[model samples]
Structure formats: C-alpha cells, structure tokens
Target: MEQSESIRELTQSIEKGTISLPEFQRDFVWDITKTYDLFDSIIRGIFIGAIIYGKPSFEIAVREVDDRPRKGQGKNRKLKIDKFTREEIANKVKVNNYRIVLDGQQRATSLFRAFKGIDEVWFIAKNESDYDYNEILDKNLSEQTLEEIIYEISGNEDKERISIKLSDVYDIMQQNWRESKIEKEIFKKQTYNGDDDEGYDYNLEKYLTICDKLQDIFKESKLLNYYLLDMDVDKFALFFERSNSKGVSLKFTDILAAKLYAGNFNLRDKVDEFKDNNTAFANNFNQEIIVRTLAYIIGDGREKIDKSYILKKLNHEHFTEYWDKICTWYKETLNFLFDNSYIVSQSWMPYENMIIPLIIFRWELGRDFSQMNEKHSEFIQYWYWSSIFSQRYTGSSNEMIIKDANYLRKVAKGERILEKAYFNRLARLQINTKDDFYDYNRKASALYKGILNLVNFQSKGLVSWENNNKLNFNDNRLEDHHIFPKNYIKKRFKDDLEAQDKMSSAINRTLIPKISNILISDKAPSKYLKEIELKNSSLRESLNKHLIPLEIMEMDELFFEILDERATKLFDIIQNILVDKQAYILQNHYKEREHQKGYIEIFATYQNQEIQAHLDLETEKVIYKNEHYSPSGAASKVKEEVSGKATSTSGWHFWKYKDEEDEVKLIKELKE
Candidate 1:
C-alpha cells in the first residue's frame, strides 16, 4: 500500500532522531564481514534500500499502560509484555499487537557509534568538515608537520579522547588522493582493526569513496525522514514482517542494544571488558551469543526465542536503562557453569531469568566476577529455571534470558545485606544448634579456608572464590590432579551432588605432579597409583605421603575418600590459618556480599532471621520483618502450584545424585 524508504533518507532522519530508533529495535550491529561489504559497496557507489514487495503480514498490539504489577517477586514494578504472531503456514494471516523493524539496524548503527566515533576517529585521515576535529596540539599547530602533529595527539579513547568528523575523513582523502595518490595506499596499509573485529577493513581509498557517496546522497537524495514515511508505525511494523522474506535473523540482546543505543548508551565497552578479562566468556561468545544470552536471562517466549516482541517492550524506558544490570546477570549466571543444581529442567536459570532475583536482591553482586561462589552460581541457576517454566521471556527459550534481569531494583539495605547466599549455603547443612552455623558455612569455614591454603604450601596457588573473578580454573598445570576427569565428572556426575562431593571433597582429590596426572589415562585409581609409585621409588614405599591406604581403589566409586584424605591433610597443614573469615577475606574480596534492602531475606541473609518460607512453584512465601506473607500470587507465579491441586513440586527433584539411597531401589538386584 506504500512506497519503500531509501538509505539516504533513513540515515538523515535517524541522525536527526526524526526517524528515531524504536525501543524494540535491535542494537547497532554491522559485523566485520558485512560492515566490510557495506562500506565497500558505498565506496563502490552502491546504495542500500528497503524493497517492500507485497501486502505485508503484520501484528499490531496496542495496550495503554496503567502501571500493572510486574510478574513475580511483587517488588512493585511495571508489567512485562509478550508478543504473539500468527504466521501463515498455508496462507498469510494478519495479526494484532505486534511490533517490527523499520530500517538500518546495521548501517545506522555505524552512523551512531558513540565510542568508535570519538575513540577511533584519529585513525581516519579526515579534516574539520564532516567531523569536528580537535587540533592535537594546543599551540602553534600551523608550524608543525602532519607527523609531528599526529605524534602530539593521544590515540587512547580511555584517556583524553579526540573527535574527528566523518566528512573530514573524505575531505582529507580527497586532497591527499588528488595530490599524492600513492599516499592513500600507504595510509591504508597503516590501518588496524577498529573496535569491532566484526567491522569493515580500513582502506583509505575504499572508505573515502563510500563517505563521498553517502555525503552526496544526503545532499542530493530526496528520501525524507522516517517520520515522513506516510504509513502509521503499525503499518511499518507489518511491512517489516513481510519484508523479512530472506529469513533474516536477529537476536534479542541486539534488540536491547538498539534500545540502549537509542537511550544513548553503549554495550561494547562492557562486552569488551568481559572479553579482555575472561577468555572463555569472550572467545567463546559473539554479539549474537550475548544477545541470546540476554534473551535467555529475560525470555524469548517460553523456549521460542521471542526477538520480535521482546524489543517492543524494551522500547519503554524502564527496561532500556537497565541493560547494564541485565548483562551483569548473564556473566554471573555463566559462572554457575559448574553447579549441579543446573542439571534439571526447573532447577536451571536462563540468563534473562537470572536478572529478576539479582535485581530484587539489587546488588552488583555479579560485577567483574573475576570471582564468584557456588551459592551465587546456584541462585543464578535456580532463577533461570524459575523463569523458563514460568514463561518469563518472549523469544526462543535461549533468548528469554533477559527476563531474569528485567524489573529488579535495589533496596535501602545495601548490596552486601542480601540474605540469599547465606541461606543457600546453609541449605546444604544438617543444622541443629548455634554451632551448626560453622558446619553450614563451607565457603568461609575452617575446612574451606584450609583447603585454599595451597598458596602458602607453595609461593603461590589458587584461592578459590578469592580470585575466581578471573577464570584460572586450571591455572597451575604443575600439580593438583583433577581426581575425577573433568569430562567424566560432567557426564556421569553432572547432576550428582555426591559425585561432585566425591570429586571436590578433599579425600578423593589431591594435587599431584602435573606431569603424572597428565600421563594417567581413564584407568582405575589403583592403576594410576601404581604408575605414580613406579615412577618415584620414595613415593611408592610410603602410603602416608600421598596415597591413604584404601581397601577399594575404584577411584570412581571412592572418589570422596580421596577428596577427604587430601582435604584432611590440607586442613591439618594449615590449621593456624583458619579463624574468622570476616577478618581476613579482604573487606570486599568479591565473595562476601550483602543484599540490598526490602528484599525479604527469605532464602539468605541475617543469621538472626527465622526461616518460615515455602518456595513451591506457586505461593513463594516470604519471611519479612520476622513474619511470613505469601499464598498471595501463588496461582499466577508458579505453574506447578497451579498444575492442579494434586500437582506437587518436588524440591529434591532438581538435586542430582544426592546420595547412594537416591539410586533406584534394587529388586533381588541385577548383579546380586
């Protein structure tokens, strides 16, 4: 019913905010290859235009906001929305209450780079026209040569940054190309990758061509603002749905990034920080991966990955401003990578879902998690599962992770006061009296402290949770043999707590000569022990030194024994080091955190607080101000609690290999 928009017209409007980015739009993304091609095309005089070919299928959802309560936690926040689309299997069908993309999710993103613009501008050979360039020298710049002037300027954006206009680059190239064409090639060779490895190759000649063309297009093209599109925003949405006939894919986090960008924020910095700090988090993940991770934290519509609608709701300011908090949730949950609680369907958490609890508790508990704890890890997992079965997201199950972080706020009590971790840690104990507190605190307890005394044994070693901020899992390959092969542990013991205990428990595990552990294959522990003994005569003759004489050497079966023995020796060797952890863990050592206030210390916090909580899927009972209040939002919050009166959730179902009794009861027994 309408004509399509062109690149020049859209870029102009986007720049003026006349065709401002829709809150639901995805982040500014022009990947390395595509970014390369776009500039290359522009350099070659290619124009990118939207070609709307048919009567598009669209969904238009319009609900006036009236401050509805956010789902779950009842922390008093705005309601979150989910989008539903009726796609045609046989024929096209029109729907209502849907949102869609408008234009330049990628190209426009390049147009508005807040950082790369100011940060990397000096690299471009531009003068002061298209860009406002600061003469690097404060005085007498006219007397110095270009090389001298360039040397005087600082290239570091983190330090004092300098801004150079895009147009200036073209003008500089025009003058340079006109006089000394060979210099363009030389300058091009000096180029390095910009902020995005996923960006265009810096070629002075090619870049100059594109900018010139774009400049011309803006000056000559008749394409108007996004506002002047003639069609209602609703129709534009419909047009976007049908326009995606090429099966274009977009991630929800990308959409959130767009919203954040619209709000004048950039995620690249934090993402880069994660990359620079944690190799696994960076090298293993991409922009899309982060988007999916964000969606996972929030939601993408059950397990469907609801990219289309998730962005729509994010358009609202409430969700947009909280992007940093949402990302924090993902990094935190990722660290829970080793928690056994994550093995089950409901006991898990998506990246999006983790945000809810994290925000409710309202602590930057997840920042620079160069170090994190199993409790933080488990809570992240638990929160993820809660969001999934609870249907927290609007996109693919993987994308709904963003749901975890949306609507979380900090209370007056400060970040360290959050009681969840203490309670979660204490949950593993069989408590009886006040002294039971010691037994429950494995993280800071004497045994735990002693286990970490490896650093003292040698000049340096790992301090679990202390330096976990940075992932140095196998930092020392010199010793500390993984009693249970990591691969084997993940496979058979993924859901097994006792199995984890067997491996992590001191008796079954110990530090060995790294070389010996490497040579040991997947044979029984006895076989490996024999190999070790034969390799070193002194070690072979003495059981007291390394091997605690065991009747059964099935390392797999008696893994905990090994863990216990080593832990015993390790603790004994460093008994003097064990005392009040609060006194020594470096006030803000990254592990001991307090929750922000108003969040009922339901699951963790305040040793003095009494426990009167029932956390079934429905009716999340809260113990607040020494009293319990729940059975309020039960029917709506929990699917299990509402699966029918007979539907009961098993708290232990999520726990893996709890004990030997948990094994299936035997008949006369298959082997017996």
Candidate 2:
C-alpha cells in the first residue's frame, strides 16, 4: 500500500477520472450540514479520516474505468474514455492502471463537489448565544466567478457571505502576486492623515492577505491522507466487507447489489424503477426486502440472508433469470393486498415484511390470484392479523421468516393445512387495544392498519368530503385528524408528554379530507360537528360511514366513554374481517353504575387548596366551578390548579364522591 497526504492532488485525480468509486462503493449520503462541517474541518486542519483505494491490474483497471462502456455498446450510451488511456499510454492503453475508492467515498465526493462550485453543498454559520445555526447557501453567488463573489460579499448587501470555490481562490492568488506587491508599494508611498484616508490602503492590504491565506490552503497538497492498495477483486471484496462490518452505514444487500452491478444488473436501479412504476409500494420497498424475497425464491429454506450467504449463492445469472418473475409476483401481492384486504397504501399495511410471505405464496401458486382458494385466502389473512397483533416480526424476524417460508412451501405442496389450532394460537396473542394505538411505536402495527382499513371500508371509498371526488390514497390527499382536537386536549394537559402522546394515538385519530382538516382547525368535536352538520345534510350517514359512534356527536366534549365505545365497535369490525367465525371478542371493562339523577359533589385537596367538582351521572358530565366538562376535562382542571399548567389526568382517579358509609371513594371505583 502507498500512502499520500494530498487533498488537492486527490481531488484532481477524481476530476480527471483517475481516482473513481467502485460499483460496490456507497453513494454520497452526507447532507448539506455535514458537507459544510467537512469544509470547516478541512479549514481547521482536522484529520477527518483516511481514504483507501484499491489499485486493480491493468486489464481490470481498464474495465473499471467510468468513461468506457461495456463490451456490447450502443451509440447513445454515455461513456468517458480514461485520461491515462488517452494521455500516458496513448496508443497502448493495456499497461495503464487506475485506483478505485474502497473507503471515504463520501468525503472525496464532498471535496470534489465543493471545488467544482456545486450549489448543493451549503455552509452553516453558528451563533454563540443562540444554539440554533443559520444555513448559508449563496444562491446569488452559485454561478458567479470568484471575483464576482468577493465583490458581492464586500458590498453593502443584506445577505450573508460565503467562501468561494477553493480552485478559483487558488487561481486568483496565483495571478495577483504582482498586483499585491504594487498595492503594498502604493500604500507605503501614500502620506495618509491618522484618519479615514488610510481606510482604502488598509482594506486593500487585508484583501491581499486573505487571498494569500486562501492560496496556501488550496495549494497545500498534503491536506488529506489516503492509502492506495494493489489488490485483486476477490481480496478487495473480502477486505471491504470486513472493514465495513464495524460500521452500520453499509448493508450486506448494498454489497450484493454492487456485485450484481458488475454484470449490468443494478439491483438498486431496478428497485427504483419498480418503485417508480408502483408508487404505492415504493416506500415499503427496500434492498433488504428485495434480497430477502430473492433468497426465499432461490435459496434453500435454511440459508440465512447475510453477506457470506449472498456472495456465495446469489450471482448475476440467478438474478437475471428470476428478476422478472419476482417483480411480477411482488406487484401481484401488492394488488392482492389492495383488492382483498382494502389496504390501498403501504402506510395502511402493517408489517411490510408480511408481504414477503404473500409474495412467496403467490409465486408458489404460479402468480394466479384467481387460483387462491378460499382456505388459502383465509390463512393468509389470519397470518397477517396474527403476526401484526402478536408482533411476530418485531424480534427474531429473520429466523422466524425462514421458518414461516419453509412451512408455507410445505402448505403450497399440499402437505399441510392452516387449521383452527393456528387461529387459536393467534387468539392467545395480545391484541393492540385502544391504549396501544396511543403509543407511537404501535402506529405501524397491524391493528393500526386494520383500523385504518376498517374506516376506509365503512366510508365505502375514501371520497373527499368537500367535492365528493374519489380520493387516491397513494397521493397523500387525506390526513388523520383528532376527533377531540389537540389544542383542546393540550388546554387540559399543557406540556405533558403523556397527554401529547394520547393526542397522537390511533383511537383519537380519524382519516378526513385534507381540506376538511383545515376547516375543522382546533375546534372541539362538538363545535365542528354542528358546523359540518349544518353544511352537509348527510352528516349522520357520513359519521356512520366512517364507523364513528353517533353518541359522540351529541357530546359537549370528548371523554374516555366515547373512546371506549368507538374502540369496541372498531375492534368488533376488525374481528369480523379477520375470522369467519365470531370466536374472539374484546372484553369491555367499563360498566354503568346506579346513581342519583342530580349532580353528585366530588372533592379533592390539591396544593393546599380545596378543589371541588360535580358529576351528573344521568348526563355523564362533570361540572367544575361554573363550566361543564367531562371527567377527563374536570381532572385536567384539577391538575392545572395544582401544577399551573394544563395537563391530561384521569378524572376517575382524581375526583371522589362520598358514599353512604361516609367514606370517600373514587368515581371509577363507585362505577365498578
């Protein structure tokens, strides 16, 4: 290995296509902030990292050249002939060699782009007092020359200034040596008053000094450190994988994709094309999923989907032969999810990996959706719901997936049957209840998607309430709205994380027309319900169509009761869809309690002050002072009185009513 500490020379080599990235090298992943930071580090003479390059043999180097096209070429193909081939060995290019980047691709790309004056790289100026940093992308100076940029920055402009391209800065200093000498002579000859007359000379001297500094920075060849290794492809591959194992930036699939790239079959490009064709499936599709799908189709059922396994087993021929068939079945699987399960979008489908099994199943059935028997369909649906509710893929996923794939293969061969025993096991799996939906982690769970599909099903189709036009789920035309309004909840639980979490929960959320969300604003459900009801005559039908409980429309404020009732209704609908038989039921815990018709006084001492509230059992409303509220609202009021901020609290747990035994018992306890 040969070592060099020269950024300028390295960047030039990159520009001339002498130091190029190998197909296996990862793309530029650094963002604008990171790019700015890299320049800052370089300016400060910080040792960022070392770049490792693999020097291939003469023949291999020629093939690896970015400018040369593959053997079978077309007139329209974009190719660049190697500079070494054109210059060093002009007529006999066979003896020339090139180095491909094995590490530090991002850092090299960053430097190259900055020197080339690419507008994508931006600097961030940090403020001392304020923690926030201001992003400085000089749009006006992007296409300007170094002199123009310097003139603009020095002018009386309101905008922030930026550094000029390093190469251009170097050129300016190189050309201005005589000019700087003459300026110094003129400044020395001038007889200036000890006043503003000397300002011009001072400014000119400072400008020339700055130019010299920039030249030194750019002309310094040993600014960066790098290692050049002479090795073959197999040795380079082994070394690359071992070195990258310690870092998570590169994946096994990424390496495998690069290997396929050598054979003119770019897995990443194909995945991107697939995504472009099926936008709905794109977000959930990734290299790992594609590799796993390929493994299921081609590998022995026991093989693990990892770097060693992929390199040893998968090759260009396997990919080229199975690529089309895999894609066909994958698309069919997506359509199957939409047509049969009412999951129109990837967002509404929990467990994206679940699609892999379905793909395998459909492929086994020869990609014929019509041939999927009722029993097979039931089994697939059961597996999806069961896996989601059970969180089967949350841990030990790779191992479990292999096992499931093996089982599925057997089922496809008519050697197994999905029976009641499987359903019974699924029934024992903990279902994500209303509370679970409130957690952000559960947002993508199967139950969450199931609920979303249920709403879509009840709506007949997701149509825009404003124009009655059928909405496309793929296009982000709809947004989830809070039934109770976030502001109203916040007013009760101010700056409370738990309260904010609940506001984002599944039970509180409902899909509505994007425009309708704006119209609703932060108004309480009671207020918006009346306004929307007045505008649309079919408001009741619309509510029912959305699977919303009609009881909520009559309420003055949202409460746990409404949430519980709606959750029960939604869970029942999901149960009906998941299983043909009504064998599984979610147990309801809240029961009505016998109480007097009039308001019952409830009291609690908070922060040395007596807090009092009233509960009307008949109306199921709580009265705090002169205002009417639900239990949650009243409890929130008590919390506000104690903490001096609105926060969510359990009214049932906080407020207690006196019993006939002269003992204070929680309202929730009384009800139970």
Candidate 3:
C-alpha cells in the first residue's frame, strides 16, 4: 500500500514509536552541510527525496535514536526519542505491523530532530537575499527557537512542543509579522516624514512580509511524500536491490550486512571490532576486503558471489563458521607475510587482495603453521615474488582469481612446484635495471615492496645504524635515506633536472634510522661510510645487510656506475633467494684503471687556502681533490669556497698556471 503524509505527521510517527530505523541501516553519516542543504531545499519549495520503509519481524524492530545533531547542539549530543521503548514497541506491534526505515533515513532523522528541538537546524534569513549555506553567517536560528514561536502563535502549551507539526512554521511566521507591525507603529510616531519615513516603513514591511513568506514556503508538508511497501523481508530485499542498482549508493557488502543483521549477526560491527583489535594491520582493512575474503572461502565463483547471490546464500551460521576459520588463517597469513616475506605492515603491502588466495591455501594445508617446511617456504616465496613481478592481481578478472586459487591449492598440497612457465612469464620483468629498481613512486608499487622484503630477508631484520639495535615494524625510528645524499647530487647536477632525478631514484634510497639519516645530512658517502666503519666493528657485514655493494664503501664518488652495480647485485640476490639457488657466484662489475692518468695538477688560492685539482687533457675530466668534475665544475667548487655560496664561474678565467715560457697565464687566455 502507498500513502502520502506531511513532514509533521512523519515526525510525529517517529516520536510516537510508530516508525524506527533498522539495525542493518548504515550509521547516520550526514554532515551539517548536507543537513543545511536539505532544509534549504525544503524552504525553497524544492521537492526533497522520498523515504522507503520495510516491515520486519517485531522482535528485531529495534530502532536506534538519531543522535547526530546539526550545528549549535553540544558536540556529540543525540536527540532522545523518549516515548517508545523496544520492549513496549514489541509488545504493541505484530510482525507485519512493525515499520523500519529502509531509505530516507537522513531526511526523516533531520525532520524528527529539528521538530523536537533536539538539534539546531539552520536556514537562510529572507532579509539576506544572497546567503550561501556553506558560509558561517549570522542569519540562522535554532529549531528550538522556530518551534517556540510556532507554539506561541498557535497558543499551544509547552507540553505540545514535542508533537508540534511541521506546518506550524507558517503560523510562527504570521506571529513574527504581527510583532513587526507593532514596531513599525512605534517608529512612525517618533519620526514622521510623509515620503522618506513612509518609504522606510514600507521597505521594512516588505522585508518582514518576505520573512513570513519564506517561513510559509519552508513549512509546506508535501515534501515528506514516500511509498509505503507492506511486503515481507525477502521481497523487500529484492525491491531494495532493484532501486539501488542504478544509484550505486549501496554495495553488495551492504546487502550482505543487512541480511546478516536480519539473522541477528552484525557483520559490519564484527569486522569493525576485528580491525580495532588488530590496530597494527588495520590501516587498509575494510568491510569490502572482509567480504571478499568470505566470498573466496565459500562463494562458488567471483561473479556468483556478488550482491544478489550473497543476499540469498549468506546466513548467520555459515558466515560465523567460515568467518572464524578465515580469521585464524588471516592472522597466520599476516604472520607469514611479516616474519618471512618482510612485509612490515599493511602500508607496505601492495596488493591486499593477494592475501585472499594465501588464506585459502593456508586453510587447505590443514591450518598447520608447523607443517611449513623449507620447500613450502620456497614455494610461498617464489609465488609471492612471481606474482609481484608479473603484476598478477592488477585488474585481474574473476576467472583469473579462480584459476590462481586452484593452482595455489595444488601447490599447498605438494602436487606441484612453481613451474618454469611462471618464472618465464616474469622473465621480462625490468626490475634488474637501476631505472626500474629506483622508482620514485616505489611505495605504491609491488616491485618496491618486494625489494624491501628482500632487504629485510638479507638483513634478518632492519637495524638502527646508531646502536646496531634490531628495529621492529612498529618502531618509528626508521626512514628512507638517500645513499648518495640529495644535496650532494644537487651540487653535482645544479640545473640538470634529468641528472638530479636519476640520482634521487629509489635505487639510492635505503631504510636507515632517523638519527643516522639526520647525522648523514648531505655529507658525501665517502665521509659517512668511513665514520660508520670506525664506529661499528662488523662494518662489511652491516653494509652487506643493507644490500649495499661493498665497493660503495671504498668509492671516492657515488657515480652512475656504483648505482648500476649495486642495483644489479641486489636484483641477483633477490633472484637467488626466490629460486633457492645456493653457491651462485656474485659477478663483480668493478673495473680497475690507472690512478690520476693523463692529468696535470693545477693549484688555486681561495679564501687564503691552497686548493689542488688535476685536469685530464685528453678526456677533459677534472679531478678536484680526488672528486671528478669538469674544468668549469672545478671552478664552481672554488667559487663556493670563496663566496660561501654556489655561483657560476668561468673555469678558463678562474684557473691560472705557469706555461712553458715561465709566465703565469689564465687558462682562458692561454686557450685564446
């Protein structure tokens, strides 16, 4: 049956315990801005949307009060619904008679809260024509004030305030006009000029008249129109789905949540509690992920496990049974990821959905953590790296997940090894190169995370450089440090953006303690490396732990050659770890050359200190105090020393030396 009711009657029904919200409905999430817009639309004679109601079992017809107030109510205060108790309502109503709001919850709650003066709802004053609802202006009133004037105009008692009709805002406006007339009369007697005074009075009268008209427009009750569905629970679900399909306001998980709620199982709340309890891994955990995991465990296929099927198939008993097992396997899987895989937390995890299949595989292994052997560990590691390198889950189809899930199930049962085909699929994965490994957007990519995992595996765990103490996942002491300091690169490149970017890529980044990063502060790798070696006895071992090539410690300058060598070494290390290859020799990429070959020493005095540099006449390579530079680049360093700031200098004009004739001449003059 369908019927129409005024906003007043609807609010009254809510107060009298005839209407309520169901437990399955989402929480009141509307902000004050939306509330303001809702009332603004109503006041402008605009048609606000309709509400949908469902008749549920009387036992489960419990309603939660709409405690979310608009602005000007005390922070975190909810409007109390005093007249009805759940017990009283249950006793009074039968199963088919219980009405629960299926839609328009925000509207009904706003109306009920406004009418009862439980919260202040604001509106633009008619006197101000250009008011925007978003701005914080003075032209607003509390719903309580609006209600008081309405009652005074209608000559209603204080007890009538609770049940005051929405239509009464019109009568309240009429009373406001009557009060304005009395003020106009008093002002007319005090200053009476025929034209100016009467014109002023007329405009004042017009403004007051507009205020009344605005109130009249707001109180119109046709805005509360709705369709009443007197159907059973199953029929209501179908109707809800069909109505919401095009709007996308509700998701499949929401319908599943509703179904679980009807069965006295609050899935959403349980998931929330799970997240709260496991706060360490809760950053990326959400209801959709939980439902997706549930679907994998019991769903026939990805497509079938959608909204419609879940609404029909999911029940409290099945959900509870599977949820418990999933929870157990989920915790175990996270432990595997952290302890073995080096994924420290959810933030470092690239694809959260990847855990779903792992959970399924773990379940098939009899949920026994002790059964995991070296072969099994290798299989898991191989699968993890291969999936990451292959980008297996990025835009994966439902059928793909089904196939992978089946494959993993076989692997878990020792039926197969991760084959050559899987490895070949990732053979072209570009992670071996410096450019590929040193990504700027590494945090969001799986390869970056995989590299971190490999580093963690090599190091046993991350450690603080300051004290050589083991740092855990929860510690905030670690940060990404540029191996070749950014400032040094900037000095080296200056205006060359491409070079700066290359130097600052992910290959240069390593996790070091915050204290160590700060202490390193733009110092050259040559300086910091020696200091660390002096402080720590196990210098070579510690350097290797960070996946740093031992050659970097001895290098005079961090060149592209160093970065490329280290990146290739790290990639090989990851490859060996993934394939369980032992006794694989690491290839040395370092090349030997004659020291200071084909170069002549040039001396300069800057800031009263003698600086020496060597210039390679054949290659045009200038070495300033063992650091490589161009001739002009060497002059820039000298200029920095002289001015205590970076400035461009002409090396030809800056450098002078005694030529073959035993006369001092500038390099520029000699070249000319």
Candidate 4:
C-alpha cells in the first residue's frame, strides 16, 4: 500500500515511536551539510524521493533514528547507533504498530532533526530574488548560493540574508499564521514614511507573503509519500534485497550478516569478538577482510572472494570451523610482519588484502610458528616487498591473489624462489623520481605507507624527542606528526591548495609522541627543532631515526626546499630497497672507468645483426630506440624485434660490455 504524510506528520510519528529503523539498518551517516541540502530541496518544492516502510511478520530488533551529525573522518570517524529495548517498544512506548524504515533512513532522520532543531542550526534566506537555488542546487553544497544562510548563524546579525531559522519555519507552518508571534514581529518591523501607514502596510504584506509560502511548503502533506510493505520474514527479505539493489546499497558484509542470522549463525558477533581483540587491525581493515579471507581459506586459496563468491559460496559452517585457527594464523602473520617488515601497526600495511596471502603462507607452512625456517621467512619477505613495489594489489587483484596463494603454498615446501625477473619488474616500477615521493598522498597512498614501513624497518623504529624512547604503536599515543606543521604551511601558502598539499606531503610527516607533537604544534621546523634539540641530548639520533636531515630542519621558511631534499633522501632509500643488482653492477663497472654521468653501452649480436643499448646509470634502465626498459624487459623486446617471437632471456648473459682495453666480457662473467 502507498501512504502520504506531511513532513510535520512524519516527524511527529518519529517522536511518538510509530516510526523507527530496523536493527540491521546502518546509522545516520548524513553530515550537517546534507541536512542543509535536504531542507533546502524541500523548501524549493523539489521531490526528495519517497520512504519505504515495512511491517514484518516476525519480531525483530528496532532502534531510534540517529539524528546526530557525522563526528569525524577516516579511522576516528563514526555515526553512533543505539538499539531500542524490547520492553520499550512492546509496552512502555505503546508501539503496537511501529514500522521499520526500509529506505530513506537518512532523509527521514534529517527531516526529524531539522524540525526539532537538533545539533545543527539552519537558516532560510530572506531575499529569495538575490540568489537562485535552482541554478546552484545542481552544484556542490559549498558552491551553492545559500551556503552562508544554511550554515550555523544563530547569532548572525546579517538581516539582508537569513530571514528565520528553519526550525522556526516548521513551527510557523504548523501554527495559525494570523495569530502567530512571527506575524506580529513582522508587523512591528514595518517602517513609517512621512507619517503615512501605506508604506508600512505594503512592507507588512510582502513579509507575510514570504512567510505564507514557507508555511505552505511544509504544510503540504502529499510532499512526503511512502510505500507500506506488509509481508512475512521471507518475502520481506526478498523485498529488502530488491529495494536496496541500487542507491547506497547495503554492504555485502551486511547482507551476509543477515543471511547468517537467519541460518542461526552470527557473523557480526564473531567479527565483533575478533575486532575486540585486534582493535588496531580492525580499525584499518574492517569485517570485509575477515569474510574475504575466510572464503579464500575455505576454498583452499582458490576462491575469488568477490561479492558473488561470498553471497553464494561462503558457507557459514566452514567460517565457524576455521574461525579460531584463522585468528591464530593472523596473529602469527602479524608477529612475522613485525619482525621482518617492521609493520608494527595496521597503518603501515601497504594493502589490507596482503594479510590474506601472509596468513595463508603461515597457515600452509605449519600450525607451529617454530616450523617457519629461514627459507620461509626469506621468501615471505621477498614476496611482501615485491608485491608492494610492483603495486600488485592496487587494482582488481583476484587473479593475483590466487596466483600468489598457490605460489606461497609451494614456497612453503621450498619448491622455488620468487624469480629474479619478478624483482626486475618491481625495480622498474619502484618509486624512482623525486616527484614520486612528493606526490605520495598523506596516509592514503600505498606507496606512502610502503615508504613508512621501509623507514621503520631501516631505522629499527623511530624514537620520540619527548623522552628519546622508541615510539610504539601499542601506546595509542603515537601521532602522525607533521615535520612542517599543517597550520604553518597553510599560513605560508595562504589559499594555494596545491602548495598546501605539497607542503603537507608525506615527506613532511613522521610518527612522534603525542606530547612531542603537541609541544611542537604549528611552529616552523626551524623554530621547533632548535627548542627540541636544546631539550634533548640525543636529538641527532632522534632526527636520524625519523630519517629527518638536521641541516634541512635548521633552514627557516624553506618548505619546498625541505620537501625536495626529503624527497631526494626518501627516493635514495627506496632505490636502495628495490636496487637491481645487474643495473647497479653495470653502473659500478662504468663508475670504475670514471664514466659517472655517461650511459653504459652494451652490445648483443643476433644472426649478424648487432644491437646496441645504453644503460642509464642512475635509473638503471636500458635505452633502446629512445624508450627505457628494465634490462630483462629490454632484452625480451630486442629478441622479439629480431626473431619475431621472444622468450625470457637473461639480459646479463645476452649483452656484453666492452672494456677500455678492447676486452669484451658478458655481465654474468663479470659477476664472477
């Protein structure tokens, strides 16, 4: 059945406990800005879509609507949800016919909050002719014409802009306009002209017309319509799936949770238990990782673990069977990662999906951590670094996941090592240019996290200036302290977002103690570093531990200079990690001849056709036909060009470098 209610009636229903949300419904995620837009659209007579309400045959948990704004962003952010007690719904509240908001939860909640004047303060523009909502409504809320009035402006004395609070608009819409206090106020504000009441009366009429229109906008009950669904649990579930197929669809995990609940298994409870123990990891990688990894493990490392795989093939029974063992494997994997990769916290992980393979490696090796030998450790480290530098898991990684998982199982038995060709490709793709490090986004980029991991590994973890103690992830006090603070850079760059972004680059970031960060807050590095160094005796060691150059920090107001210097230094570190031995060996061979800047020329002969190539000593890439490639990649290309088909060839043995005395030697022989 279909039903219609005024915005006021819907809000009243919410208050009276006749309107509620299912326990499975996600909490209100609308920010204050969204609330502004919702009311703005309603005021303009725009259709904001209809709500979908359902009455289920079976009893289910229900909750009150979350009318609060979004608290934070990223890891620290959440919209709090509170479930209503059964007793309150059944007896005390007297809600025998309450309906669940199957759809439009955000809209319904936003309307309710706006009507009640909760948390956010909103205002309507008095001069409707000054700005057209129709024109700017299609754009972002920040770019809209009504941005000023829609914001919190309760104390604002801008008489030309805001006419009234939106809450007051709702009140006036429900009140008798002629007898309302607002109507009397409008009449009182009327001005006199030459002792004649004509001008005052004209002004009074204009103000009343505006108020009437605002009243009529909310007073119209047909504007807020809803579809009422009355069905059994099974039919209701089907309707829920179909109705939610588009437009902010439920997360696969949520759907899976619902399915498991019906089957007498609680996926969410198990996930909550796991997350309770591993807060850091769970904070970064949520329940999706848990479900996906379980599916992969259950399939013996062959499952795609995509939405289809999870919904159809993921057996809750298998999940329960392997849950405890998988948890143990994850812990062991973390232990190994901490020792080798220096990823002590979830923040440093290059990719969350990397956990799947690492766990699988540990699980496939043995039940005991003692069984992981030197070879296993070496292989795991190689795979870990190779995958990160190659950016293997950046995009669609299902195929790569299966491939790597199978290889890891074999590697566990010492069947083979990750090929040199693999590392060669990783070296080619590794962060090479100074711009690469500078462009690495703040905490969001995998390469940025990879660099952090590398720094942590090399420095054996950074020490804090506060007490010169190594900053630990377990402390919960480690902050992403900006070397050049955000406020300092914002003031320096002043409205240049690009310059601000560059200044706030990951190169300008390092982990420090919360106290140290607070003490150093917003002060220029030149000013703060001096004070910090004066207070700490091991300042040099602390700076070195964070890979911060002492001389660079001493330079006042050279943010870009610091950025460039740190970028070069970080690139050097990354290059060392992904250093191709053949490239380095050839460069070193050329260095011996004092040809530091010039390219290393190597030659190959195939069927009397001589091929010449130049190796860039810095980048370690071969230049043939003006295109750069890794030695092996170039070798394959050259062979394919001449022979019309190419197989993998050892570039070391194929190309020969000529000595100054006319002696030619294969690079492989030179290695000896």
Best by lDDT: 4
Q: What is the alpha-carbon lDDT for the whole of candidate 2?
A: 0.59
lDDT of 2 by residue, 392-499 (tens): 777557766765665565455544522333334555545445454454424555656656665675565654444444556565655666777778778755666766
On a 0 to 100 scale, what is the lDDT of residue 42 in model 3?
63
Global CA lDDT computed for model 3: 0.59
Q: Which stretches of candidate 3 lie over 4 Å from their true place?
A: 1-6, 9-107, 117-255, 272-290, 300-312, 417-435, 438-440, 476-478, 495-498, 516-521, 527-540, 550-556, 574-672
Instruction: Put down candidate 1 lDDT per residue, 1-672, tens digits, no spaces.
Output: 334454444444334433333444433434444544444344344555442222223222211111222234543553233222324210322232122235544554443331123222232333323233555434342443333322122232211212233434444433444424433443334334233322334333333443444455444443422222334324444555555544664343544453454344445455777678766556443454444334433432233334554455433244444545655554554444322222111111123233334433334443443354544443343333333323334344332232233212221122222223322332232222222222322322323222322322222322221111221433333234454565556565678875654553334433333453335545555666556555555543233433344533434566555555544554443333222222332232223323223332123111243223333222334433344434332222233333433333322221111112222211112111
- TM-score top scorer: 3
TM-scores of all candidate predictions against the true structure: 0.29, 0.56, 0.59, 0.52
Question: In candidate 4, what residue range of length 10 has the lowest lDDT sum?
Answer: 585-594
Stretches off by above 4 angstroms in model 2 are 1-19, 24-49, 54-99, 105-224, 227-254, 275-287, 342-344, 417-425, 432-447, 454-471, 492-502, 533-536, 574-672
> For residues 1-672, what per-residue lDDT tens digits would candidate 3 score against the true structure?
456577766765776777877555556766656665676566544677788876543224244547554455554664332232335545545642546788788788876766665544433222222334653345343321332122122212222121122333433543544655544543233222124333655544533444454454444566567877665445655666566622546554655665566556777778887778877656555566556567766763334444445555567777777775777678778777777635655556657777777877787788566687665666566666666766776674344455456556766776652233333453435465445776643466666666665676666775655556665555555566777888877886678776586675667776666654347767778778778767776766766767777777777464677777777877776567643332211111112223334656666777787777776766666678678877788988877877888788778776766543343445554343
Candidate 3, residue 447: CA error in Å?
A: 1.9
Please list all clashing residue pairs in model 3, or write none if there are none.
Answer: 67-78, 438-506, 438-507
